[model samples]
Target chain A: MMRNKALAAPFVLWAMIFIVVPLVMIVWYGVTIEEPIPYTEIVQPDGSVIYQLEDGSRTTEKPWQKRAVFSLNNFRRMLEPTYLRLLLRSLKVAVITTAICLLLGYPVALILTGRDFKRPALWLLLLILPMWMNFLLRTYSWMSILENSGILNSWIARLREAIPALDEWLLSMGVRRRIIFLYNENAVILGMVYNYLSFMIMPIYTVIEKIDKSLLEAAADLGASPVKSFLRVTLPYSLPGVLEGITMVFVPAVTTFVISQLMGGGKVPLIGDIIQNQFGKSSDWHFGATLSLLVMVVVLAFMGALGRIDKDDEPHKEVRIL
Target chain B: MNWKKNLRKAYIGLIMAFLYAPIVMLILYSFNNSKSRAQWGGFTLRWYHELFTDEAIMGALGTTLSIGFLAAAISTVLGTFGAIALFQMKRRPRQAMLSVVNLPMLNSEVVTGVSLMLLFAMAHIQLGYVTLLLSHVAFCVPYVVLSVMPKLRQLDPNLAEAAQDLGATPMQGFLRVILPDIMPGVFSGFVMALTMSIDDFVVSFFTTGSGVSNLSITIYTMAKRGISPKINALSTLIFACVFILLIGVNLQDLRRDPRKGKVEKVRIPY
Candidate 1:
C-alpha cells in the first residue's frame, strides 16, 4: 500500500504545473500593471531624440520599455462603473436563470418520480437529449427562433394577415408590426434557462426519486395532508440535491459568454463577454485576469457557502461533470 | 382525479416542448433550399451536400475527434492510477488532495480557460493543438478520478491480499482481481471524459490558436458573422449522430443487464 502511493506522484506533478500554476499565473497577471521604465530623452543634432533606455541603450524613438510591476490598478479599474455594472448584470441574469430553472424543474422532478410514471427513465432521457447536441448550435437554434424577423415573429405576421380585426386591435394597443425579442437581458436569461434546465432537473429528480416511500406512508398515517407531507418529508430530504442543482446551474450560467453572445446579439454584455473581450478585442490579459479573479472569487464564495450548508449531509451520491 | 393526472402529463409535455423546440427548429431549417433563414424555403439537401463538402468544417470535425480521443485515453490512465494512489493514502492528505483536484471543476469555465491561456502565454507554449489538448486533459482528469474513487471505496480491500496469499504476485493479483472489479467505473469515466472533451467550447476557445479549431469554434465564428444553412445542416447531422450513439450505448447496456442498465443510464453525469 505504501509503495502504491507513488502512483500519485506523476499526477500531482501534472496538477502542480497545469492546474495549480496556471491559477497562480492568473493572480500574477491580475494584480499587476505594466509601466514604462523611466528614460531620458536626448535630442541629437539632427533633431531626432535618441531615447536613453532603462538598460542604458540609446535608440531613436524606441517604444517605451514596459515592465510588469505589482499594482492594484486593475482592481481599482474593476471597481469602475462599467465593470461593476457588468458584474451586477451577470449576477442578476444568473440568479433569475437559476430561480426559473428551479421553479420549472422541481415540479417536473416530482412528476417523474411520482407513482404514475411507469418509465421515468425514457422521459428523463428525452429531457437530457438536447444537451448532447453541440452547445453553440443549440444557441444558434434559439437565435433562429427569437430573431427579429425569425419564426415567432413570422408566425405573428401570418396571424395578423389572416385576421385583420386582430391586426387593428394590436395596432390600436400600440404594438409594433415586429416586436424585438432578441438582443436584451431577458433573451440572455432565456437562452441560459434553455441550456441549464437539465442540470437543475437531474439532481432534484435524483434526490426525490431516492426518498423512501415508507417515510411518506408514515407521514400519511399521522394524518398529514398531501401538501403538508411533501413540505415536511420530501422537501427536507431533497435540500442537498436542490443545493447541488443550484451550484451546477448557477456556476455555468454566471460564467457563460456564448449564450449571451448569440442570444443577446452583442447588445447585452455580461461580465463573461467582457472577460472574453479582454483576451480577444481588448488584448489586455492583465485586465482579463483581474476580471477572471473576480469571477473566480464570486463562484468560490457561492460554492463555499453551499458547502457549509451541506456539510452535515451525506456525501453526494455521484460526482457531477459537464 | 383524472383531470389532475391530465394536468401532470400536460406539464411534462410543456417542459419537453420548451426543451426540444430549438432542436426541432434546427432540424427543420437544415434542409431549407433558400439561403435566407427566416423564409420557409422549399426542402432540399443542398446544405447537407455543402456540409459534407466544406473543407474547414470537416477539418474542425477531425481535430475535435482526434483531440477528444487522445485526451480521454491519456486522462483515464493517469486518473485511474491517481485514484488508486489516493485510496492508499491517509485520510487527511487524501481530503486535501481531493480539494485541489476539485478546483478545475468548481472554478468558472471562463476563468479556467483564461488561466490556461495565461499559462501557455507565460511558458512560451504556442496556443494550438497541444495547448488545447493539455487543457482538456487537465479539466478531464478530475472527473475520471471522482468516478473511479467511489468504486474503489466499495471494493473489498482484502481480495488483493488473499490472491497474493495464494500463489499470485501483487501485480498479478491486481490485474486478475482488482482490475476487473473497477473496470466499469473506469469505462464510465472514459465515456464522461470523451463527452466532456467533445462538448467543451469555452476552454478550447481561449486555449487554441494558429488556425486550429474544433467544431464548436467553427460554428461560433460562422454564427457570429451571419446565419448559415450549412451550420444547420452540420448540426442536424451531429444531432442525429448523438441521438444514435446514445441509443446504441443504452441499448448495449440493456442487453448486458436490464436492471443495471436502467440504473447506469440514470447515473450518467450531466
Candidate 2:
C-alpha cells in the first residue's frame, strides 16, 4: 500500500499542478476582464476612431482601483454580430473538414482492411510518412504549393499547352490554368484534412480490420450486394470508431488557429483565431474567456452526445490493424 | 462479382495516389534548382548541400532530436510500469484509468497548448528546454500507455504461470515471460512518442522559451515572415529522416509475419 501511495503521489501532484490548476485558470481568466479593455472603443471603417464611453466618462488618468475588475461585459459582447460570425465560421469549417476527411479517409481505410492489396504495410507507411514531418512545415509546404506562380501553378501552365481544353476550362473559371488553389477556403479545408485525416483513418482501419471476414461473407451470402454488406454489417460494426475519430478530429481542428492564419490568408476568422487575437493582441482576457467558454460549450455538447451514444456497458470490440 | 473486384482495384489506386501525391511533390521540388519555390528551374543538389552547414538550423535540429530522445525514454519507462500496474487491476477501475490516460490524445492541441502555457505561468517559471520536456512527457506518457496496454492485456497469462511453476520468482517470471512478450509494443510505443515529440509544433511552440527553438518553430517564423528557400532545404532533410523511420516501422510490420521473419512477434490478439 505504501509503495502504491508513493507511485500515485507524483501522478496526483503532477495533475494538480499541470492539468487541474491550469484548467481552473482558463475558466478564471476567461471570466475576468483584463487590460486595454473595451471601455469606449469606436471604429470608423477606414481606421479612424472617436473612442469614449457611452456614459461619457473619459479617463486618460490611470485608475488603480479599477485595474482588476471582473465583469460580464465580455460575455455580453458575444451578442455582437462579429463574434456570431466567427462561431458560425468555425462550425462550418469543422463540419466540412470532418465530412471531407471521412469521405477521403474511409475509402483508404477500406482498402487497407480489404484483402488483395500487395504490401498493405507499405501503403500504411506511405500514409504515415508525411504525417511524421514537422507540422508547421507541412502547413507551410501547402503555402509553397498553393502560392500564385508556385510549382503547382507552374505545372498547370506547362500542362495547359499540351492540353488546350484544360487551359480553356481553367481560364473560364477565372483562375489562371497555372493556379487552381491558393489562399482560399479549399486550401484551408484541405490543410486540416491532410493533418488530421490520418487520425481518423488509423482508428477506422483498426476497427474495420477487426471485423470478422466471415460476417462480411455471410452478409453477401444472404443476397446482399457487396456495397450493401459493407453499409449494413461493416459500417454498423465500426460506428464506435467513427464517433471516436470524428470527436478526435473535430475538437482540435475547430480550436486550432495556426492553419487558418497561415493558409487562409487571415482573410476569414474562425473562433480560434479570434480568441487568439483577443488574448494575444487586444489583451482582453474576459472576452477571450467568453470565446473560450463558447468553445467549451460546443465541445461539451459534443462530448455529451458521444457519452449518450456510447452509454452501452458492453466493451466495444477491438479490431486489430495487423 | 466483376464490378465488385473492379471497384476495389480503383479504390486502392485512388487511395495510393492521394497518399503519395504530397510526398512526391515534396521530393520532386526539393531537387528543383529554382530559387523561386514555385517554379521548377531544373534539378540540382544545391539546396541539399546548403542544408548541411546552416548553423541555426543545425542547432534547432540538435535541440529537437535530444528533446525527442529524452522525452521518449522517460515516457517509455513510466508508461511500461503504468501498463503493468493497470493490468493488475480489476476491469472496471482499469477502464476508468484507460480513459484518463487517453485524455491528452483526445483533447484539442490548442487546449493542451494554452493550458500548458497557463501552467507555466502559474508556476512562475521561465519556459525552457525543461518545460518543453516535461509537457511532452505528460502527453507522451498517454501515447506510450495506449501502445503498451493493448499488448499487455493480450499477453498469455499462463506463460508467467508456467515460469512460476518452474520455481522462478515473480520478478523472474515476469522478466523472462511477460516482459519479452510486450517489448515490441513498448518499442513501437517509444518510436511513436518519439516521432510525435520531434514533429510536434503546437505544444512545443507554447512551452518553449528563448534559446529553446526547434525545427518547426524555425519554419513557422520563416513562413510568417515570407517564404524562404532554406525552409525547403531544412524541411527536405527532416522529411528524409521521417521517411526513413516510417519505412523502417512498416518493414517491421511486414517482417512480423511468423512464417517469414526470424522473430515470432506477439501482437494484441483481439
Regions more than 4 Å wrong, model 2? A35-69, A158-180, A308-322, B1-7, B84-100, B155-178, B252-270
The most accurate candidate by lDDT is: 1
Question: Per-residue lDDT tens digits of candidate 1, residues A1-322?
Answer: 3255456688788888888999999999998988888788998898878888778887777666688999999999999998999899999999999999999999999998886566576678779989988878888888888888888898899999999999999999999889899989999999999999999999999999889999999999999999999999999999988998999999999989999988888888899999999999988999999999999999989988787322321233221110
Candidate 1 docking quality: incorrect, acceptable, medium or high:
medium
Could you tell me the TM-score of chain B in model 1? 0.92
Q: Candidate 2 at residue B216, lDDT? A: 77
Q: lDDT of candidate 2 vs native?
A: 0.72
Total clashing pairs for each candidate: 0, 5
- Give residue B233's error in model 2 in angstroms: 3.1
Candidate 2 chain A least-lDDT 10 residues: A313-322
Ten residues in a row with the worst lDDT in model 2 chain B?
A: B261-270
Q: Best-fitting candidate, measured by TM-score?
A: 1
Checking candidate 1 for backbone clashes, the offending pairs are none
lDDT of 1 by residue, B1-270 (tens): 889999999999999999999899988888888878778879899988888788998899999999999999999998988887767666666667787788888898999999999999999999999999999999999899888988887777777777877877767876898878999889988989999999999999999999999988888888867767887787788789878877776666566765633443454555
Question: What TM-score does prediction 2 earn?
Answer: 0.82
TM per candidate: 0.93, 0.82
lDDT per residue for candidate 2 within B214-264, as digits (tens), equals 887877777777645566666777677766765775567667665543222
